[model samples]
Target: HKGQELVMADIPGLIAGAAEGVGIGDRFLGHIERCRVLLHLVDASLPGPVEQWRVVREELAAYGGGLENKPEILALSKVDLVTPQALAAKKRALEKASGQHIYTVSAATKQGVEPVLDKLMEIAGRAQAMKVESDKSWSPI
Candidate 1:
């Protein structure tokens, strides 16, 4: 928003063996190294949603390169497909497992999207600022 631009790359869903060049994981994971932030969207309609989230995290940790340390905005996608009770349970499980606030969103209904984007913008802005500060610090004194 504003005069600045923030681009979000839609990377493929990472599988278990992604860190070892399984499927297209290694290639895409490499691209993630240069990213300022990671927006991890979990498909709430799927079975074992928390496991899905963990798998991606495991792959990123295995990939190394400080990928595990990157700032992650965890979101629950496809919320429109699940019932209110299921959604609430998923939220609790995901939040407890990931230890982060989970943003529930449905692109089809456009529900809970703006708040997520606003949070993303704030995080990205701070990340960009830190990078610029770090870049300026790399000087021989």
Candidate 2:
């Protein structure tokens, strides 16, 4: 590596019915539970974006560890594969469907990647600050 201070782990994606002992369920998803941030990358060109997102959520919730509340950055990956108009429409539908911050990016081309990374950094920084504040509040004065 580049002498990076932080470690990045790449875990296998949790599939449908993962919580019920489906394919590679227990083997990979437990790692996700320990993560502080979840970068959810959904393929937006799919026929039903909302339903797909919900199914993923359900799988995570069933797996437990309060992942449902963890801060998530939704990115409709593979935008380069779709037309701009189509992407925009899907993004809107996904936003209305998830009620969360959404970003569109094509990982292959590096389009729209910086903004998402910046936002994620900002979110992580805030969470760290809040944790410090919470810990301080609990200390005996």
Candidate 3:
């Protein structure tokens, strides 16, 4: 990865039923309205991780404001706590569920994190370049 920097805002409250203002998740979601991309950090060790992913997807879809349409990076965190077989299983499940590349990372062991950062940098950089081009194309005349 290049030495590029990206700002990531962790919307710490997103959970099931957030769109209905069921919890503080709704409040924090507004903060991400301007973000170019979303990083969904799902816990890999959770039971039925796919179900959990679906619940968040439902909330985003319900929340509206084009959140559902944004490009997303899906990651399964805390892989160090799970066995290799379990990690592979969870990864496969998430990839099938999201139809996107799934990344596994563990902070404690520093495993598979660099790829995540590199992906983020590439995507966010592309998004920023597009935004700049879009701004230049605006013509009120």
RMSD of each: 1.3, 3.3, 1.4
- Give the per-residue lDDT digits (tens) of candidate 2, residues 33-126: 6666778888876777777788888988998888788888898988888998988888898899898878999888999888877766776667
Q: Which whole-number lDDT from 0 to 100 does residue 79 have in model 1? A: 98
Residue pairs in clash, model 3: none
Global local distance difference test of model 3: 0.86
As a whole number from 0 to 100, the lDDT of residue 30 in candidate 2 is 77
For model 1, residues 35-116, the per-residue Cα lDDT tens digits are: 8889999999997879999999999999999999999999999999999999999999999999999999999999999888
Q: Where does candidate 3 stray beyond 4 Å?
A: none
TM-scores, all candidates, are: 0.95, 0.83, 0.93
Clashing pairs in 2: none
| Candidate order, TM-score descending | 1, 3, 2
Report lDDT (CA) for all predictions.
Answer: 0.93, 0.79, 0.86
The worst-scoring run of ten residues by lDDT in candidate 1 lies at 1-10
lDDT of 3 by residue, 1-141 (tens): 466667789888477888888879898878778898888888987777788788888888899998898888999998988999998999999899889999999888989889988888878889899999999999999
Best by lDDT: 1
